[model samples]
Target: MHHRGFDDSCGLECVENGHDSNKFSLLCSGSAVTYASFSSQNESKAKLASSAAPDSGATKGGSATKIAWEDTFEVAMQRARTEKKPIMIDFYTDWCGVCKQMDADVFPKKDVITESDKWVSIKINAEKRPDVAGAYGVTGYPTIVFAEGTGKPLSVIPGYSPSTEFVGLMREARAKWKPEAAA
Candidate 1:
C-alpha cells in the first residue's frame, strides 16, 4: 500500500490474508510518516519502502541479493547451522548518509559483491530490527557485524569503508568467523 503526503505522525493498519503470502509495499512522500499495524489472523508482513526498493540499474550484479531482517531469520539461522557460513548483518537506516555512502562506494562494487557472496548478506534497518541491533550492540549507523549464527555476535566493522578496504574487511570477516570462509 502506497501513502503520499502523510502527516509526520500518521499511523497505518494492515490486514493480511492467511491463504496467500502477504506482500506489502508502502511508500511515503517524505520522511514524515509513522506506520503501525495489527493483525487479527496470524500472518507475516514484509514492508518495502519506496526509497529502499530496488531501482533500475542501481545494482550492477544480477545476483546481488537482499533480505530484510524480519523475513529471513530462519533462513539465516539454517545457513549458519547447516553450511557453517557466518551471516553479515548490515545495520543501516534509510536516511543515514554513511549508510548511503557504503551502499554506493562499497557494497555494490564488484570486489565487495564478489567477496560478500561467500557469506549470507542481510540488510537490516536498525529502525526495524532494534532487537537484532541491540543483540549485536550496534551503537551507530552502517555497522557491519559478522556472526556465526543469527543471534551470535562475532566481529564488527564500523563506519564507512571504500570497496577495497571493505573487501579486506570481508576477508577479516572470513578469518574471524571461519564458518563464513569463502566457498
Candidate 2:
C-alpha cells in the first residue's frame, strides 16, 4: 500500500506503508510511533535513557530534567512501581491538532520536562489503543491522566493546556495522590 507523508505543517514526516502486529508504525522525524511490549527491565531502561534527550531548543543542563517517556502503559506502570513515582499518561491522537501542538510546543519546554521527570511518563495514541483509552474514559484528545504507582488514577485533566498550566495540574495531581486510596 502507498502511504503518503503526513502534513508538513505539522512537523511530522511519514512515508509509512502499513501496520506491524497490533501496533501502528509511522516513520516520523524525532517521534516514536511503535507500541510493542518491552522484553526486559534492562532493555526498557536503556530505551528510556536513550530517548530522554532534551529537545533541540533546550538550553544547557536541560537534559538533566528531560522526561523519559515509556513505550507502553504497562512499562510506565512497572517503572512507576519500581521508582515509586506517579504515572502520567498522555492520551493523544495523531490527527488531533491540539495533541500535535502539545507535542511540538508544550512538552518540549524546559519546565514541563523538568517537572515531568518526577513521574513515569507514557504517551498513548488514543485512536490506536482504543481499549486503553476507553478504560480511562478518554473522550477527547490530549487527556492527561495522573495515577499512582499501582495504576490507580489520581486525576484526569482533559483538553490542551499550556506548559505552565500543565505543570501546575501535574503538581496538583501529585499533591492529591493518596496511596491508601489506591488500596
Candidate 3:
C-alpha cells in the first residue's frame, strides 16, 4: 500500500504491547488506520505475513536467479560498510497485500533486480522487527528506504511502484548517494 505520509515520530504508534498479538494499527501521517482483521473463514494473512521474510526463495521474474537480499539487517549493514554501497531496505508486513504484490511484480522485474545490485538490499518484516521499522519512521507497508551505507536515509519510496518506475527510483537513490556524506 502507498503511504500517505510518514510520521515524524517514526510512525510506530500502532505496535502492540506483545509480539504475539494479532491486533495492531498501521498509523500513517496523522491518520490511524488499522489493517483488516482476519476472520475465521478467511485464510489468515497474518499467518502468511508472519511466516517468513518476503525475499525468501524469491526469484527474478520466475527465473533461476535470485534477488540478493542480505539475510539480516546486521549483515546487510556489514556488507554495505565493506562494499561502500547504499542500502535499499524494504520494510513490509505479512498481512499487507500490496507488499506481496511488490514482491511478486516489482522486486522480481529484471530492471529492479539489476538495479538492486548497486545497493545492499535488505528486507525487514515490520511486524517481526518493529524496532527497526520504528527507527526508520515507517508509516506504511512496503516503505523502501534508501540510505547511505552507514544507515542514514537519504530518500524513501513510501509505496508500490511498478518495475519501470522502481528502476528509476533505484537510480535516483543512487544518484542522491554521497560517498562522503556519512563520513
Compose the digit string of candidate 3's lDDT tens values, residues 1-183: 232323344333343324325434455554543342223212333433444336575432224255687768998887888878899999888766657767766777777877887888889898888998899998787789999989999897776566787888889889999976543
Best by TM-score: 3
The residue pairs in collision within model 3 are 10-137, 49-94
Candidate-wise lDDT, in order: 0.55, 0.65, 0.69
Residue lDDT tens for model 2, 1-183: 534445444343333334522222233454543222234333423433344322223332225645667777887777777777888998887555456656665787788888887777888888889998998988776688999988778898876566887889999998977654433
Candidate numbers sorted by TM-score from highest down: 3, 2, 1
Between the candidate structures 1 and 3, which one is better when assessed by lDDT? 3
Positional deviation of residue 113's Cα in model 1 after best superposition, in angstroms: 1.0
Per-prediction TM-score to the true structure, in the order listed:
0.59, 0.63, 0.68
Per-residue lDDT of model 1, residues 1-113, tens digit only: 34222223323233222443332212233221222222321221222222243222332222755222323455667765665667777787876544655665466677776
The list of candidate 3 runs beyond 4 A from truth reads: 1-53, 58-64, 181-183
RMSD of each: 14.6, 13.6, 9.9
In candidate 1, how many Å is residue 134 off? Answer: 0.6
